[model samples]
Target chain A: AQTVTQSQPEMSVQEAETVTLSCTYDTSESNYYLFWYKQPPSRQMILVIRQEAYKQQNATENRFSVNFQKAAKSFSLKISDSQLGDTAMYFCAFPSGGSNYKLTFGKGTLLTVNP
Target chain B: DAGITQSPRYKITETGRQVTLMCHQTWSHSYMFWYRQDLGHGLRLIYYSAAADITDKGEVPDGYVVSRSKTENFPLTLESATRSQTSVYFCASSEAQMNTEAFFGQGTRLTVV
Candidate 1:
């Protein structure tokens, strides 16, 4: 079984600043995928970024990036130039490759971008 | 619109009543998933289907049932609603390609009183 952990329950960042949300997971499988999803008050789950366990380079998408450390079993999300729209509940998820396509998600980190 | 959609955006049901949540996708994805979102728990997978007529249980499968009679539709049913079953449910679909992203629906908010 794979478990994702997000130590921070809540986080706040000033507008135009940068913020990093921490995530760690436990999985015995060597091949897998890590993802960060954002859910706003609208209750829609949106994919932020994704990282392949085999890739050494981190994944970056616009202002969102991931620091994927396969050895440490850590995958953190960094939001640069944070804006009010970035204020949402961020969740770290793990999807096991192979026969299982189910996703294991962390509790989530509520991020508030204050102006 | 090449996306997934969930019906009955909001539902209210009494205890012991049967309720069904509908999920449909236009992408013709090979995989469909059902998940529940709660306050403390971010998201938990309830059930998933690889293709039509092939379904599997996920982390939290109790008190819930799902079926994929068609390629684009996956419906989740609560045989007997309970207060503990009150939560937001989300439907997602993904292709068979490796590392493919899963598209999510707006979600359905269910309240069992």
Candidate 2:
């Protein structure tokens, strides 16, 4: 079974500063998909960004971007100019990728953006 | 109003009791999923449905039951609740196409005592 791992359980950054959350996965397939999801303290979850393994270029969404290293099996999320609203639990996910497109998520990293 | 939603945002039940979690999506997506979120285990899949009358078990489907007679409704049931089954449950839906984006609903925090 494939698994996603987020090493940092908690992280923090000052408002307007930048922060990076680390994630890794174990997969043998050359082409796949990876994703970053944010769950606000209010409990509403949203998709931050997604990356396709087949693409060499990384994916970026506004102030959010991903550092995807296909070889190292690492996919890290970088938040630039973080806002107080950015304080939430971020999760990394991967698709099962065969017949079932089920998503397997990692233990989230709690992020706090100080004002 | 046109998105996925889960009922009983918070639930408390006793062991050996049967409880059901309701998930409804307005999108009528072809795929719907039920996942349980735990402290260290992340979100483990409990069950999924490809369409009405098409359901499949996921990684953690042992104590849970699911049915999808309608494309817009997918309900998860716990035949016999246990303390270990207490966790935040999330319901998500996506299009039939692979690699498409999946949207999640506000989770249901279930507590079994």
Candidate 3:
């Protein structure tokens, strides 16, 4: 079984400030994919970033990046120049390699961006 | 219209009653999944379908029923809705292969009284 864990329950960051959300997972599979999802007040799940297990270089999408340490089984999301809209619940998820593509998600961290 | 959609964004029902949630996707993705999100539990998979008529139980499959009659539609049913079953339901779809990105729907907020 694969499980994802987000240690931080809540975090507050000033507008335009940087914030990092921590995530860790337990999986025996060597090949998999990690993802970060954002759910705002509207309750829509939005993809923030994704990292492939084989890729040594972290994934970056504009101001969103990841610090992926495969050895330690850690994947953290870093949001730079964060805005008020970034305030939401962030979830770390992974899909173990297989045919079903089942996704396991973390409990999530409630992020609040204060202006 | 072009993306995945779940019907009755918000629904309220009584306990022990049977309720069904509808999900449809236009992407024709080979993989479709149903997940439940609660306050403490972020998101847990309930059921998933690899293709039309090929469904499998997920982590929390108890007290739930699912059917995939067509490639575009996958409906989930609760034979006897309980207060514990009250949570947000999400429908997602992805292309071939588990490594591909999965697209999530807006989610259905179901409340069992």
Candidate 4:
């Protein structure tokens, strides 16, 4: 079984500041993919970023980026120049059996960007 | 209209009553999944379908039933709703290709009282 862990239950960052949300996982499969999802007040699940297991270079989407450490089994999301709209619940997800057929997620980190 | 949609965005039902949640996707993705989100549990998979008529149970499938008679529709049913079953349900779809990201619906908030 694959399990994702987000140690930080809650995090806060000032407007225009940077925040990093840590995530770790345990999976037997060597080849897989990891994802970061954001859920705002509206309850919409939005994809923040995605990182492939084989890629040494991190994944970047606008102000959101992931520091994926395969050997360490760590995938952390970094949000730069944070804005008030970034306040939401962020989750780190993993695909079970190395496929999207069975996706698993972490408990999530409640991020608050205070102005 | 071009993305995945879950009907009855909010539903309230009595215990022991049967309730069904509808999910439809326009992207024709080969993989579809149903998950429940709760505090401290994040998102737990309830069921998933690889394709039309090919359904499988997920991590938390005890009191739920799902059917994928058509490629575009997968409906989840609760035979006897329980208070513990109350949570936000999400429907997602992804392409058959490996390493593809799954797209999600707005979610359905089901309350069993």
| Residue lDDT tens for model 3, B12-66 | 9999999999999998988899999998888999999989989999999999999
What would the TM-score be for candidate 1 when compared with the true structure?
Answer: 0.97
Per-residue lDDT for B27-111 in model 1, tens only? 9999999999998888999999999999999989999999999999999999999999999999999986557778899999999
* Second chain TM-score for model 1: 0.97
Best candidate according to DockQ:
3
lDDT of candidate 4 over B19-98, digit per residue (tens): 99999999899889999999988999999999999999898999999999899999999999999999999999988644
Off by over 4 Å in 4: A97-100
| Model 2: CA > 4 A from native | none
**lDDT, each prediction:** 0.93, 0.91, 0.92, 0.92
Cα lDDT, model 1, residue B40: 85
lDDT of 3 by residue, A3-115 (tens): 89999989999999999999999999888889999999999889998999999999999999999999999999999999999999999998866765677899999999999
iRMSD per model?
1.5, 1.5, 1.4, 1.5
The TM-score of candidate 4 is 0.96
In angstroms, the error of model 2 at B51 is 2.0
TM-scores computed on chain B for all candidates: 0.97, 0.97, 0.96, 0.97
- The Cα error of candidate 1 at residue B60, in Å, is 1.1
lDDT of 1 by residue, A40-100 (tens): 8888889899898998999999999999989899999999999999999999988876877
